[model samples]
Target: MEIRQHEWLSASPHEGFEQMRLKSRPKEPSPSLTRVGANFYSSVKQQDYSASVWLRRKDKLEHSQQKCIVIFALVCCFAILVALIFSAVDIMGEDEDGLSEKNCQNKCRIALVENIPEGLNYSENAPFHLSLFQGWMNLLNMAKKSVDIVSSHWDLNHSHPSACQMKELGVIFYNCSCLVLDLQRIFALYSSLKFKNRVPLTWSKRLYGVYDNEKKLQLQLNETKSQAFVSNSPKLFCPKNRSFDIDAIY
Candidate 1:
């Protein structure tokens, strides 16, 4: 009898469980579970794929642009470095041509003038002429000072009386009637004076002449004059190989 009772109790529980399962089957899945499944399916299909691709492309473009910018900056820096080096070399060469403190004595160039104007001829003159002359003078004077001497012969009657002071200041004049005179005669007078003073004189043949081999020689001669003056005149602090002479008043 006890065995039958145990079997009936187990059977009753099995039947009740079957009935509960049948009732639960008609209910739909939980709302939360259904939403989770839908989200997973949408992610797999990539419904917002267009927006995602756009964002990805934008990011890639930004990175590439940053790299290009870095490269351009490097190139600019390199160009600047090269330019600085070239400029330094040019400056060194120019400075080398100049006389040092040790050689600043006993060297000078001299210019002899014939019919110089009354006042100092320091004006550069018309535009272009003045610019070139002034530039050359600046280069020369930086190396030395005090031109040797300017001399000419003037017959006071024909000469501009204003030029008289020039003669007094070592600018000797012999046969000049007035400052208004021939250019060649003036140069000749200057050359003659240089010869007499025992001072080496150089000419800038192209003061207003053709720019050919002759012009280059004149410029070279000008440099030579500077050198001679520096070497010879020890009283002044100038190099032995720097002297310049100018026929122009400036």
Candidate 2:
């Protein structure tokens, strides 16, 4: 029956059978697109998860870095504050080391040099204020040699009568700029040497260290005193006044 049907279709041109045959040949079904879509979705989900995890890690690291930076800034600020405080303290200490008010005024010795001539018949050319000019004139008469003076304050620019008088006295004046003005020390030194009777004891200033000339004189004096030590008796003997019994008596 199949051969007869084929022979008949060949003889008669059966278009319906041909069409039916073409229709019967099954069309290839599109490979399950859903499965591929699911796979693609899963891959996309994994990539999203990885990206999210990386973003979270990066955010955490950035936050930690921010915190660290804040802490570092605070530490640097604290260090700067400490350094400024120490620097201020150092400056204050340096300033304080110079002198004090109590020592400055107390150490000064105001010596009355000489009495001025009262009523010396002052003319327009010679105005003699006894109290002021007398001491200065005396100082001028006294300073015939080099005068080394040390004091807390000195105004060399001011041309006072005393300053002029000192210049006239043939004195090479060297004023010391120290914290305290100890005129008493110089006076005492002159007194010890008995030069007080001759020279005017009004020192214009005060000093700090022992100068070369003074140090040399002190050394020479020390040497002289050391030489005298040979003539003096040695202090090796014990006191005879400390009585002790011969035996075990207390």
| TM-scores of the candidates in the order shown | 0.31, 0.31
Question: For model 1, how does the per-residue alpha-carbon lDDT over 150-176 read when each residue is reduced to its tens digit?
Answer: 233546565435444443222222222
Residue 134 alpha-carbon offset, candidate 2, angstroms: 17
Scored by CA lDDT, what does every candidate get?
0.41, 0.42
Q: Would you give me the overall lDDT of model 2?
A: 0.42
lDDT of 2 by residue, 1-250 (tens): 9999889878666777778889999987567987898899999999999999999999999999999999999999999988666633424321222533233222222333323333434577864333545655565676656444433377776465445344222221122212212233333333443543443332212211112211211111212321100000111111111112221132
Off by over 4 Å in 2: 1-31, 90-250
What lDDT score is found at residue 62 in candidate 2?
A: 100
Show model 1 residue runs off by greater than 4 Å.
Answer: 1-21, 24-40, 43-52, 91-161, 167-250
